[model samples]
Target: MSKQLPDLTPIGVVAIAALCTTSLLVGVRSLGALQRWELLVFDWMIRLRPDDPPDPRLLVVGITEDDLSRFGWPLSDRTLAQALNQLQQHDPAAIGLDLYRNLSQPPGYEELVAELNAPNLIGIENDNVDPPPTLPEARIGFNDLVSDPDGPIRRNLMTFEIEGKTRYSFSLRLALHYLQLKGLAPEVSPTGAIVWGKAVFEPLTSTSGGYATIDAKGYQILLNYRAEDRAVETVTLSQVLDRQVPPEWIEDKIIAIGTIAPSIGDVHYTPYSSTSSHPFMAGVVIHAQMLSQLLSAVIDGRPLFWFWSEGVEIAWILAWTVGGAAIAWWCRHPLLLVAVSAGGIGVLVLTTWGIFLAAGWIPFVTPVLGWAIAGSGVVAYRAYQSGRQQQIVMKLLGQSTSPEVADALWSSRDHLLKNGKLPGQKLVATMLFTDLKDFSTISEQMPPEALLEWLNEYLEMLTEVVQEHHGIINKFTGDGIMAAFGVPIARQQPEEIAEDAYNAVSCGLTMSDRLQILNREWQQRGLPVIQMRVGIYTGPIVAGSLGGKERLEYGMIGDSVNIASRLESCEKDRQSSICRVLIARETLTLIREQFVVEHWGPLALKGKHQMVDVYRVLARQQKTGEVPVEPPVDFPQPKR
Candidate 1:
């Protein structure tokens, strides 16, 4: 038989599972929990990178508790002027006073105002604080950092509209001033992003990276934080005022001054806070880090964090979903599947980590979850299909077939079965039909219960004989049985077909002997004894499952099957013994060499148009220790 069509069930299952899982993850991501997980993973990826050395061009002067004790809260204007004067003398590229100097703390206000007029000094302001009244707007930048809802600073606000005018951030102002000193001024790219040399600073959107619903009102970008230990070079405000700081540390570097004392309450959480002993970084250090980031990207060619478009990200997640399902489909063993699935998840995580290291921010948690759910769906579907197939096979073939045959049928199910049912196939094999002689008369002689018991005992013996000879009892018609050899699995070789015919003839002979013993036992027990008629034929027949799903059975249909049944009841006066076996010329042709058979002549079988030569299989051909010549006779050819 030709091979059946390839099964599309697995592919279908994978597609639906992957699609559904992808959709679910996408929906869940929109609900925010998945987005938060992805952000956490992003932080971990950042933390996992090799430590970046402290940038030599950035310095932070933080006022500590000692400074507060020495100069009191809100340092006097004279003290502030002294610090600025010391920093200016070092010839720094730009000085960013992270402290809001809008309010006056006077004792020497004139001195503070005069020092703030330096061309490179940038004053800080916030929504609640104004820039120094004496300082020009060109000399001011807002010292505000954007924090996520969960309280970690991860983005830098570059510029925002205030009273229909653009105001720059503290970090941006310092970075731009430092770059301008090196003759590398910022310019707007064709796409409207900030461009300096080959670096393009793209602003972040509400959906950038792992952020799903961020308030992206101002121009912002992902803050790529450096290692905590070497984030920036720092010195105390008292040290700056005492002129103890090295001039080289300030020369041509962007200097940021702010408070770092715990009592000052200027500390904020950062991505490294979770793993660091100090879970917060001073606000001054964050501004220095942001400024350093911009300078490095523009001058040193360091990369900025990037992200894939929404469409590309979705496709990437779907790819992993399909991959997970494919892995499950290839691995049939549960242990192997589990092992491979774990490995698949490991590979996915590593891949995303590697990409993150390259400054490409893509989703990790969503794809991992999607992969797991899709693989599980496929596994569950396979389990269901396996149980369903087992039930259908048992229902159609029954339990009479031998274990080896049943296994073989199951193994070749991909080729033998279609849509949970056996497809019809044409094969050249033997069919055996058996009937209890005078079954009607025997039934009348006993009550229903006793008759059922007697019939079951005889049928059980017949089923065992058929199974032993590798034949399947296709179905039962009242007291008669229709059994087939070389069924479910087609015989590919002519020799195999001939073997099936030999087994069918041998099975009939065994039945004759088995019936004799059964009759003797019944006679001894004072129960009614009965005879049997068995007819065997070898020819082409179409075999497959019959009836709908609710009621099903394996059945054979062909002229050969009808002939087998007709031979069993052809002539009642022809019984020569208690159990009789008659085979057509076709079956006799294959087993004639091994059996002694009597030629009963050609006769027209009921419902058959042509005459069929019948033979009586008496017993095994007696061997005389010598080869015997076979007689030749003309045989009728079967119509195709």
Candidate 2:
């Protein structure tokens, strides 16, 4: 009976693969390479977002090269005052001047200062620059953009502390001004998050999403770009000053005015602005995007970018690791493993990208790397284990079995072998014992070298006959050989056991015939001629690999094995042919009708208390017509 293959590799490989792959990925992630890849993936997803219509609540008044050419760089204070006055004439909800004005120009300096004092006008500043001196601290907001180490701006700094005073960002101030009319003011939630109306602006941590360690000093959040390119209605400074901009474009909307000329160098890289078509965004436009994000979240219920906690993210990575390992363990074929692994990765990528589209930022590259590495590790381990088992099985059988049997053994190795060793099993099998008739006398007559060579020749010929009959040469006993049939894999049906018995007898007869040829050859070469004795028995016996890892062999252990050995030496003086074969009743009973045998009445074997009926197998019963042989039933069968 064949045992089913255990689920050891499939089940155990997952744990091993996940543990090893996760450890490796986590360690490498600490080195920062994984975070870079994750950021790149984030950028790609952002770029793939569908284009959004321009925000109706905001407008950008850019100072273009054409405007710079028309009015010269850093337009005069009077020109800035004229533009601010024109925007105010439209009754805009709020206007952000994204330019430094710490020092005033001579002409219309009072006019610019008066405009800066307007309740709806907010002036920008940062640690490196100061706001217009005319604007009070309440009307000033910082414009600090936080860029990742790789040169792309992915985060927004909403607020910062300067001299023990908390200040809002320019974008946040504009958004708050717009929301103030709705009676929704920014308040701190119990969890220390900023809650403005319906949206909770969760602050980022040093290990948020894919960031290993970040300078998350100020209140920061992941920036979710509204579009791949500009998504706000825009007009140049000259267009506004020339009054080409319609009044409705600025009315009741947040307006931002800043330099957009490449030579002005106010441009910064964003997810959308990384391509050749739109490589960088004006600082003013980025602030506009941030304002749009905040207002839309509080008023329109648009979600801000959210991330799983570190624990959740770690669990997510482990899940994919197990997924990859499971795939590799189940798929033994190379092509199938690759195809399934690719499909697994595809699913992971789609899942993460979908979440990102919904404003959820999660790790992508770490999970992907963990998945691929775990699967590959399992595949390599399985391959190594298979090779090792094959070697052990081949060694156990002494490489003396037929190719068909050897292949069958290996294919069923997962069942027949365990932990690189074959466990002992009771099976109904045939044991054949062979020895030179007078080996000690023959060695005395010839030199040691000649004797060894002659003995090897006889054993080699007998080994071939044994293999041809589907039997395994278990071990060499110096001048003798021990072989087994219906072993490694136990025979379930009586017919299979009977067949094993018949084949053992047939192999003995074939060996006897080949010996005659060898005798003639040896006589011509002046070598000693020889005769041999073969004992065959079939019954229940224990079969398994015996000995430690250093030296192992297939062992047959049972009284049946001992009986077979005794038969070969019992009544040794009664030789009647070149090879005398003796069989116990247990073996003759199974093959009595196929082979002609002479019954040797009950006799005691060397190590047994019970008497046994032995027989001498002379030849096969040649028949002219088809004859049906009834299956043996009285023979001692192995327990199920």
Query: Could you say which candidate leads in TM-score?
Result: 2
Candidate 1 local lDDT, 435-491, one digit each (tens): 976778778879999999988889999999999999999887778789989887889
Which clashing pairs does model 1 show? none
- Every candidate's lDDT: 0.85, 0.85
Question: Cα miss at 558, model 2 (Å)?
Answer: 1.7
Instruction: Report the C-alpha displacement of residue 625, candidate 1, in angstroms.
Output: 16
| Clash statistics: count for each candidate | 0, 0
Residue runs of model 2 more than 4 Å from their true location after superposition: 1-17, 20-24, 31-33, 104-110, 273-276, 326-331, 376-391, 547-553, 570-574, 584-640
